[model samples]
Target: MNEMNETGAHCHGDAAARVAEISGLFVSIRQILAQMIDGIGVPDARTPKTIIAKLSELQSAHLKVLAAEEAFHAQQDAVGGADTIDMETIRADIRGQLDRIRAAQDAGPLSGGAE
Candidate 1:
């Protein structure tokens, strides 16, 4: 990694972290939905009201996820002008691309450009 670009490496790490956060949030949202579904019938007094609260929480969670995704995209866009930028990074496939880029760099320039 000493040869790889710092910002590019950070971009990949940040994207992966943000994506994992979003995925965890989605998991929570799914659990809430499942709870809501489970409480469909039954004479429990936690019906409609509980469902409404869960829905509101779910909405908030989704909004947070969206914001995280937007921020992640903005970070990637900021890195777009860098020489280290590659098609994989552009396509949001950071892991694969960065790994390949590091490998390429280690192997020396394949052609003329600084891959």
Candidate 2:
């Protein structure tokens, strides 16, 4: 887990928006793992350590993508660009990742390894 420094009191409007963002993050994570599992579909069903490492790397990248999105949103808000937030574009990008994850899942277990 990454460390977040909490200094000033945090402020946010619209509880629903916060909830939505959190929900999206979790859904994205789930989708990512599911895709990994699918791509690495177990004839043996147990992910070996190396495969697990790859999954962790993928998760880290996914989190970075989410954090970057949040940072972009914050920056836009700070600069009065909130109205220009291209939610559709963001969603589309996420959808693309999800699709890739699914394809990877379909690729079956990692090759050249004893799980």
Candidate 3:
């Protein structure tokens, strides 16, 4: 039996589950983008900068998904695979992403925008 890691996440022999978790994140990202496009709640609420900011977050999510997939693959213990994952690079990306998100939120919503 595999013991759960300190984060309560399954370790070893759980590649499939980890992949499924990544898939779920992708689904959420799609839903968020759709909502932003449809503007279902507020008419003309999305500002130009707001859209850009959201895209920044999208990029952040993209990097995370890429890293997750890389980690998932490496966990498989395959004979041949891509280079090992770099924890430092991933951490740096997330820090930058957080800054972008905060700046985006600072831009706030607009009273008038594309409807």
Candidate 4:
């Protein structure tokens, strides 16, 4: 059963790694959002444009993470049907990332107005 244990450990380790990577992506997105907010007062469109580009890059990374998470879920479900896994934390993180992105989008483009 040592091989089984090793396999299980590997699976868990992989899952944890995925979670950590996704979490880091979300954190980076949040940081970009904050940077964008700070960009609002820069009085230069170029600054905000750079910030927006960074945000877009973060968004792309987030999408990639979401895709990987979805693939992981699909594989787990295929292996064990509905009893496959508890991916709630990962799902929650994805949702949180989405909400933050939406909020940042809704905040509107950076403005030159005074604080």
Candidate 5:
């Protein structure tokens, strides 16, 4: 039983290390691409600058998504599994925020028209 637990823990650690490695690789790739784009200004007619810009944007967005996913997973694990919060609860929270925003919008100018 003890050996099984140890093996499980080791596998979890390995998974975490792999995630970190992948995250680092994403950052490195983004940086390298940005540097390459910078080094060659005024791309040839065949290679538009917008293409590189789009690739950079894609990488940046991917990193953000991965980071958010990792954060969500960590939070889920910290609070004991993903089922801790039901869909209804999340939807209710969103609804509450929307209600608050709508109320604020309805309130109109808060400065009392003083300028």
Candidate 6:
């Protein structure tokens, strides 16, 4: 039926939109990780504090992404179809980036050396 087809199309479109939004969040987290990595070699006294602040920011963004993904999953479930996105893989990637950021913080200078 034409109505059924239209509904199906709408669901697919919705799934695609959610995927795009999740992908953008992943990109944002990766950018934060890149910034943390770049900060590693800076010799300023406040570099550690700055990195910690950025890590906190990254965690906050990560929580938002997770919440969005959960909502997306719920929507998909309501539509009754297989998931269009591999949420587990995306979560693993995010975790890995977070781990790397934590490692960088651990390896960074501890003393408040002169900037």
Q: State candidate 5's TM-score.
A: 0.40
Best by lDDT: 6
**All models, RMSD in angstroms:** 13.7, 26.8, 25.1, 26.0, 17.7, 27.3
Off by over 4 Å in 6: 42-115
In the predicted model 6, the residue pairs found to clash are none
Candidate 4, residue 111: lDDT:
86
lDDT of 6: 0.71
Stretches of candidate 4 exceeding 4 Å from the true structure: 42-115
Model 6 reaches what TM-score against the true structure?
A: 0.37
Candidate 1, position 109, lDDT: 52
Tens-digit lDDT track for model 1 on 14-110?
A: 8768767867776776677556645553434655786667667656766776677678668766766434657455556777788898998899756
- Which clashing pairs does model 4 show? none
The alpha-carbon lDDT assigned to residue 71 of candidate 4 equals 82
Off by over 4 Å in 5: 43-115
Question: In order, what lDDT does every prediction score?
Answer: 0.66, 0.66, 0.61, 0.68, 0.70, 0.71
Give the per-residue Cα lDDT of candidate 1 at 87: 49
Residue 100, candidate 6: Cα error in Å is 58
Q: Cα deviation of 82 in candidate 4 (Å)?
A: 17
TM-score of each: 0.35, 0.35, 0.31, 0.37, 0.40, 0.37
115 Cα displacement, candidate 6 (Å): 90
For 1-115, candidate 2 gives per-residue lDDT tens digits of 1121121112224534675686687678768756875686543457588887776777777777678767856854676633455656876898999999999999998889785
Residues 1-115, model 4: lDDT tens digits: 5786578678878876876687676567667656665554444456667666766665676677567667866765577632355556666798899999999999998889779
Order of models, best lDDT first: 6, 5, 4, 1, 2, 3
**C-alpha lDDT of candidate 2 relative to the true structure:** 0.66
Could you tell which candidate, 5 or 6, scores higher by TM-score?
Answer: 5
Tell me which of candidates 3 and 6 scores higher on TM-score. 6
Candidate 1: regions farther than 4 A off:
1-4, 42-115
Residue-level lDDT of model 5, residues 1-115, one tens digit each, is 5786578667767867876786677668667756765665555678777876776776676677568767856864687633344746776898999999999999987975665
